[model samples]
Target: MSFSVEEGEFFGILGPNGAGKTTTLEIIEGLRQADAGTVEVLGMSPWPRNPKLLPRIGVQLQASSFFERLTAREQIRTFASLYGIPAKKADDMLTVVGMEDKAGTPAEKLSGGQAQRLSIACALVHDPDVLFLDEPSASLDPQARRNLWDLLRSLNEAGRTVVLTTHHLDEAEALCDRVAIMDHGKILELGPPATLVRGLDSATHISLATGTLSLPAAREVAGPDASVTDDGVTVTIATRAPAPVLTALADRNLLTGIQVRGATLEDVFLHLTGREYRA
Candidate 1:
């Protein structure tokens, strides 16, 4: 619920549905008013919609809205004109988001992912010092998602601060310098992804193709400290000590279909926020 993002830091807020991620972003972006706590962004208060702060920050909401009947290029140009930016800069922004080819396409005709990219371009057209994105990649396909990630990384490297809210744990791990995990409008944990994952002290998971070894044989090989389970498709060995188990598997030639995964951001997130489904 409370944190500070250093200058040029890539900070992420992660949570499940109804966890107040969107609401928090809205408050920080000065789109909504907060109830009680004080907020100081870039040494400026965001509440009451400070006019001086508007030019320094850019915001892309979960859902994008555009001027009626405008093309993708027109939509961004309009945004640029508000900040006294040239049309050329707006065109360059379209190229930056891979929308140059679709520049002439009507806003209503753009797909969800394409529209998402356009919205990002519009936000960046003004060359704001800080950028805020909420669920920016939710509508993107895998390839598009990777492209957006690359774009964001480049922007951050250029000394722009980025504050993001997303449900994707992997995105937070890949992009965030630090992340705050929220649940029920509260921060449950805040740290670098690797540090938080290590703090969990969780077990390693070594999975093999089902029937590679019988359940009884696997139990015998893994020893008593390790827990083994098979749900027909895969046999998983959960162990704090993986070296011995891996050696055992290698000795038996059962490593052909093996998969090994250590604790990750998702593990820490689920541990803190619970595994139940959220609508």
Candidate 2:
């Protein structure tokens, strides 16, 4: 429930659905009143509706839409005008987000990724000190999502403080300097992704997918403590030393897939929360 994002840090808030992330963002954005507790952003209190802080902060909601008839350039220009900025800066902002090629395209005709980039352009048009994005990668394809990640990193490198929420644990691991895992309006874990994941009981995970017939022998080699997935096709061996486990499983030719990796954020979350992350 309490955390602070350092200046120029790419902070991320990660949680499953209905984890109060949206409400938390709204409160910090000065769009909603909090029942109790102090919320400070950019060294200014976000409560009581302070006019001076609004202009210094930028926010892009999970879903963003512009006038259907307006081209991407026009939409950005309109926002620039609202912010008392020059129209020429719209083109500059478009280039920043890789939307210059689509500037002439209407908002209604733009792809999901293009539209999201335009929304980000609008958020940056005012030149705010701090930017907040909620689930910015939602509905984007894998390639588009990765592209957005690159854009966000570039923004951070250019000296912007970005706070975002995401359902993808991999994104949290790759993009965020520090991540807070929240559930039911409370933070269940908080730390850098590597530190949090490394705190798990097992240092590594050996995952293998096999048929029901191989489950018995797989568990035998994996030991009594190995975890068998609910579907029984997947068996995971957790240990710091995976050599013996790997050697034992190598003899079995029924494995459809096998992988050995360190404990991940997802593994830690499942251990802590006793459930899979649902987004």
Top candidate on lDDT is 1
Worst 10 residues of 2 by lDDT: 225-234
**TM-score of model 1 relative to the true fold?**
0.98
- Quote the positional error of residue 18 for candidate 1 in Å: 0.7
Give every collision pair in model 1.
none
Q: What is the C-alpha lDDT profile of model 2 across 66-132, one tens digit per residue?
A: 9879999999999889778999988899998888889899999988778888888898899888999
TM-score of each: 0.98, 0.84
Model 2 Cα shift for residue 138 (angstroms): 0.9
What digit string (tens of lDDT, one per residue) describes model 1 on residues 1-279? 688899999999999999999999999988889998888888999888899999999999998989889999899999999999999999999999999999999999999999999999988999999999999998999999999999999999999999999888899999999999999999999989999999998999999888889999999888899899999999999999999999998899888869999999999999999999999
* Backbone clashes, candidate 2: 0
- Whole-model Cα lDDT of every candidate shown, in order: 0.93, 0.82
Clashes within 3 Å, all models in order: 0, 0
